[model samples]
Target: MRELACDVAIIGAGTAGIAAHGAATKAGARAVLIERGPGGTTCARVGCMPSKLLIEAARAAHDAREAQPFGVVAGEVRIDGRAVMQRVRALRDDFVASVFSGLDAIPEELRVTGTARFADPTTLIVDDHTRIAAGSVVVATGSSPSLPPPLRPVADRVLTTDTLFEIETLPESLAVLGAGAVGLEIAQAMTRLGVQVTLLDPAGSIGGIRDPKIAACAASLLGDEIDLKLGATVESAEAVGDGVRLTWRLESGGQETGTFSRVLAAAGRPPNLSGLDLAAAGIACDEDGLPDFNPRTLQCGTAPIFLAGDANHERPVLHEAQRQGWIAGGNAARFPQVEAPPPWPAYSLVFTDPQIAAIGQAFDAEEAHDWIIGETSFADQGRARAMDRAAGLIRVYAAPDGRLTGAAMIGPGVEHLSHMMVIAVQEGWHAATFLDRPFYHPTLEEGLQSAVKAVAERTGGTR
Candidate 1:
């Protein structure tokens, strides 16, 4: 067997693994990156980039259809599903190639093209042929879609984020399972693309928004474009002809059934640690098989071993994965002298039409009792009205001292607006600070000014 040595060995070449590899090398540590498949990250190959391409196409089609309401008649719009999908795949391949170009620039010997298993705390066996003796290991194996129990039997009939984009043609009808970010985004995009889409979620909210007011607004707006079955649980799923039939229990004590051309399951994602042989490395895992790790440091219970990205299951988004990778790689390079940096404030955004975003404390947190709330409706906002998207709301929260604590919004531009709140919460900015900044009129941002000022006034600040 071939033998190699390195200061740090990164498993999986996804977003986190790639970031860790770069950080370790930049920190003067000899790093080796291992992977079993093509080296493109998930976002580039499947998750974010390709999905956004499809959503953009769907949005364009939807916008053209809705243009008639503005007294500007657009001729009959027809969607060419095959052409749309081909374009997505073409652009997706280019993204994957770009990622490969970076990987190729790395020394060839440092890239291992095989699955790795833990032989010991500081040793990795790659495909039983080569052994790597590393001072530290960073596991960033990412995650896989989680299929629910009822859908397992008909798994072949269900599509996931990992497989949905590979379809040659869009389904005429789709029943989307789960109302989280993936489910809601795809449901809206598919609906706009002329698919009969029915979205089912056991939770009461859409896009995982915990605020009842915002959730209700999201449901009403999205439901207007598609069939949204909130507070509905899938009871059974079975193969029906070439498709699948699903029976679900509604919140109102009624059972409903639906058969669709396809079922896209966006249930959730679980850590991908199936065959890593982690026990050999003496890593302790929880009931759900997740390794215990420090959220701030990204280090596992075992010394010299760290978990980053979706493998830790702390924060599964791409940005969090990148941050965790940098921390884990730097700490792994330093080993026993690991540094713990202060954690960043939490922020998340869902790119559904009338995007949903949350920063810092969630809308339904118990601590909100001590925080003053301010809100604005987008129904009358000038920009929203002009764009024919005047159908959402924004809510901001501030502490007793008027410092911005949290904010959640469901509106046309909340994806970008949420970043403003992220900076406010992270920098300890007061509500009045937002007022001091100039907000251009007739923009969605002006609505945020109103919300911020309302919170400032409630906290006894000068209007």
Candidate 2:
């Protein structure tokens, strides 16, 4: 067997692995990046890009459909699913090519590609043929979509986020198994594209991570276009002729049934730890096959193996994955003297009808505490009103002393809103000061000020 050596070996070339390679090399460590398949993130090829492409198509179609309402009567807005698929395919190809080209821009000495499995603590078998002896190893292997038991047998018609992207045509109707970020986004996007959609979740409301009021507002915006099966679980789902049948139990233990042309399983994701041979490296994985590592350092049980990204037992958001990757890469480069990376502040965005974004601890924490809470409806935002869309809300949560604990926004421009919150959370910005900071007039940013003022009022800031 051919053998090579490096200071660090990073497995999985998704967002985390890609970031780790650059960070490690910048830190002056020799690193090799190994990917089992074509290099690009789920966000690149499947999750974010293609999904958004589909959504944009739907949005255009929606606007055309509404043209008549504005006294500009037009003929039917028809969509050629094949053309949509073609555009998405071209975009996906370009995205993959761009990522690979960027990876190549790194010093040639810092990258390699192939499947890699642990041979031992500091050694790996690459592509089951070549061996790599490294000083330290970082596992950035990301997670895979979780498919529940009742739906697993229908893998042919039922799809995961990864599989749904490859489909050539849109389904006439889609049943989404989870109302979390993935399901909600696709459900609404597909609904806008003229597909009948149903979204089911075991949680009491959709976007379970967000505040209840925010989630409810989002659901309201979705309207009757998509049927919501909140607080429901599928008891069974099977192919019935050209469509599928689903029997579910509601939160109240009441039985319910439904049918659709396609089923999408977006329940969640489990870490990709199956073939790593963690046992050979003396690393410990939990019953779920995820490494038992320190959240701060990502150090697996022992002997220089570290976990990053979805492998570290956290929600698999891209930001968290990138943070873990950078931390693990830096730690691997520095070895024994490496100080652990700080605890990552959690953050994420759910891209449903009205996108839901949050930062810091999720809003459902059980701390009994004094808080300043404020909300601004999208109706109040000038930009949203101008866009003819005003069906969302923004909220800020602050401690009794006015420190920003968390912030969430469910509406248009959420991606931009999230960028500001990331800085606010990281800087520990005082709710009152940041909220009072000058905001561009008639913009969604006004929502930030409104939320801050609301929280301040709750904290008796007026006094």
Candidate 3:
């Protein structure tokens, strides 16, 4: 076996792994990056970029169809599924190419195109041939689409975020399992694109929004565009003809059945720790196969190993993954002398129409006594009315002392509005801080300002 040495070894050339590689090299450490598959980050390949492309196409088609309400009657709106998917793939390829170009800039010897398994606490074997003795290792292997056992038998008929974008033509109808971010986004997009879509979620809420009101608003809004089945449990899924037949039990103790041309399983993702042989490295993993690690430092226990990105299963969002990657890489490079930065406020967004956003501590009814609630309804907002998209709500939470603590919203432009709240919550800003900022008229952001002011006034601030 060929032997090599490096200061840091990074597995998986996805977003987190690439970020770790850059940080490790910048820290003056010799690092090697190993990737077993295509080297594009998930965002560029399947998760974010391509998904957004399809969503944009679906949005345009929906907009054209809805324009008749404004007296701007366009002829029958038609979507060529093949052409639409082709454009998504074409653009997706460009994005993936850009990522590859960046990877190509790194020295060839530093990049190994093979699977890596732990040989020891500080050693890795690549494809059982080349051996790497590293001072520290950063595992950013990311995650894989996880299908429930009931759906496994019909896997060939199921689509996931990882495989949905590869289809050349859209299915006539689809059954979307799970109403989290991926399921909601794709389900709505597919519905708008004229596909018969049924979205199922075992939870009472949708989009994983913690705030009950926001979750309700999301379900209501999305339900208008798709066949939403909340609080439904799938009993079984079987292959029937060329499609899938699914039987589910509703929360009301009733059974429902559906046969669809395809099934899109967005259930959840499992950490990609499967062939890593972590036991050889003495890394203890939890029942979920995730290594115990510090969220602040991204270090795995006290060992010279670190876990970052989706592999850690802490915060699987792209931004959080990149942030964790940097932390893990830096700590691995400067082992025994780690730097732990102050944690950033938590933030996440669901990209469905009337986007759902959660920032900082999500609102909980049981904890209502400790928080002051401020809210606004987009149904009456001037901007929402002008756009004919008036639906949903925004709720802001503050402590008795008037400091912005958290917020959840389901409304037009909440994606941008939530970022503003992220900054305020992270900076420890008071509700009055948002109220003091000027809000442009007939804008979605103005609705956020109104919500903040309402919260501030309720919390002893002068309006």
Per TM-score, the best of the predicted structures is 3
Give per-residue lDDT, candidate 3, residue 341: 91
176-261: candidate 2 lDDT, tens digit per residue: 99887778878888888878888988887776555777767777777556888788989898889888898999989899888889
Comparing 2 with 3 on lDDT, the higher-scoring candidate is: 3
lDDT of 1 by residue, 1-463 (tens): 9899999999989999999998899999999999988568888887999999999999899889888888988999999999999999999999999999889888999989899999998999999888999999999998889888989989899898899999998999999998898888899999999999999998888887887788788888888888999889999999988889999999999999999999999999899897898899998787899878889888887479999998888978999999999999999998977888887777888888889898887776687778899999998989989888887899998889898888889998988788888988898989888788888878888888888888999887745
Estimate, for each residue in 361-450, the C-alpha lDDT of model 3 and write its tens digit: 867778988898899999999999999989989999888889999999988888899999999999899988777877888698988988
All-Cα superposition RMSD per candidate: 1.2, 2.3, 1.1
The total of clashing pairs for model 3 equals: 0
Tell me how far the alpha carbon of residue 117 in candidate 3 is from the true structure, in angstroms, after superposition: 0.8
> TM-score of each candidate?
0.98, 0.93, 0.98
After superposition, candidate 2 runs with Cα above 4 Å error: 67-72, 106-113, 365-369, 458-463
Query: Ranking under lDDT, best-scoring first?
Result: 3, 1, 2
lDDT of 1 at 411: 91
Whole-model lDDT, candidate 3?
Answer: 0.90
As for TM-score, the candidate ahead, 2 or 3, is 3
